[model samples]
Target: MAEETHVLDRPPEGANADWTIPQHWDRYTAEEHATWDTLFARQAKLLPGRASNAWLKGLDVLKLDKPGIPDFEALSDRLMKLTGWQVVAVPGLVPDDVFFDHMANRRFVAGNFIRRPDQLDYLQEPDVFHDVFGHVPMLADPVFADYLAAYGRGGQRALGLDALQYLGRLYWYTVEFGLIAEPEGLRIYGAGIVSSFSESRFALEDPSPNRIAFDMARVMRTEYRIDDFQQNYFVIPSFEELLRQTVETDFAPLYAEMKARADIPVAEIVPGDTVLTHGTQDHARSRAAG
Candidate 1:
């Protein structure tokens, strides 16, 4: 994994309170662009059979298949026309509130740098490739686009209620690692899975992780681990349904209830779960043993 060099919820010195910086599209070197090409080629090869139709369609619509690192201005032009969403540059991770504010405005904050070639297989911080390739494509799907905007709005509200943790898990399961039930089979849509070549396969084919139907309350009450493949993946029936659940429901009451309840462990398969796949958990056990 790439070293965890990111500044956590705090903005670095001289950064604007929101922690945004220029992408300096002109500054990328030939080596950096080449890194992007290599990673792009690797992911594009695997995505067609494994990714959601919407995600594939979005890739074409956004013209992400063309070549080397995409110019942010050029990318934003096309994205703005499709969904009013645009990519913005950031140094690294931003404060939660700043992140929510950007997303609320339909702006996605991406790291300006690309990982070195040696770091291709893993990176602790999100790079331009992960941000744009993994995430921007989904923004082209209108239903998902609307859902993101709603999630951003919800993030702002969660802040006032002191419930950001509850809301953050929703984003983790749905946006970062969510699966979808397509007519053909379950397909990957979550950006985290889409970005990682190994995870792209592991998330779908591995029987070591539980695949459960999306449950709003359960997702909110669950914890996530950042250092490894997720132990459980939540599958949504459709983007429309996911959007409806998040947009139509008020979360204030839900937050209060969640605070009164204990959190679910990351690897536990609780009762009442709509289990899609009962994982053997061998992968997690093997990792622990190592």
Candidate 2:
């Protein structure tokens, strides 16, 4: 009922910035590993045909079944073989620049804490459960891997443009919470959607949110909700396609244009929208009233 509390810079369960002591992988409690297993098992069960093949393949390549908090050194060894990307530990959400720097260098900063079992379905900030479980698997894919690094570089430029609102939308619509249309139907690829139980279902089956075809410009100008299920989901045709389009086209000029225009609210249906499902948005409205 109240505004979702913000707790930035809170280090994960056993993290410290010394970066010298090597990640004390042996320090994660047994209960903590069980938490990762629980979340991993739950989402693995739910994802089947729902998530993209790249994400699924990533899960296998990462060998995530070894359990407990993954030893970053081991995971990094395997990950480098797949996409040359490595995961590092972080406090919580770092400043935009720090996050972008890590991403640009192909180093993903994951929170060291696992979510409390009770917080499985949701958490205020990204924890190990959300960061590794949600994002690591997809990083194994080469093309999507490149896209993320590029986005990180782009983040730096976008910050300078005073267009973070638009740039953040780019991340919201694609990286964190997005879907891609497969030959069979819409499939989940975005880490944010795949990691949350409620959103996993809401994104694909619920009619409350609009499903629009992915449009770079339209998405950069859109707004998204951070605390709840998104009011809209942008669908891409394929990860490779999604990456090619974004990496090849420079967003510098695009950001310049977006800065001059009004940012679209979460649920608005615009004329140029490549609308897939035009919802009455009853679900979001009902929640608001309650």
Per-model TM-score, in order, reads 0.96, 0.92
Off by over 4 Å in 2: 1-22
On lDDT, the leading prediction is 1
lDDT of 1 by residue, 1-290 (tens): 12436656676666676787777888888888889999999999998889999999999998998878998889989999999999988888888788889998999888878899998999888888999999999999889999998999999999899999999899999999999999999999999999999999999999899999999999999999999999999999999999999988879999999999999998789988999999999999999999
lDDT of 2 at 280: 74
Query: How well does candidate 1 score on lDDT at residue 153?
Result: 91
- Give a tens-digit lDDT track for model 2, residues 200-225: 88899988899999999999888888
For model 1, state the Cα shift of residue 136 in Å.
0.3
Deviation in Å, model 1, residue 28 alpha carbon: 0.6
**Model 1: worst 10 consecutive residues (lDDT sum):** 1-10
User: Pick by TM-score: which candidate is best?
Assistant: 1
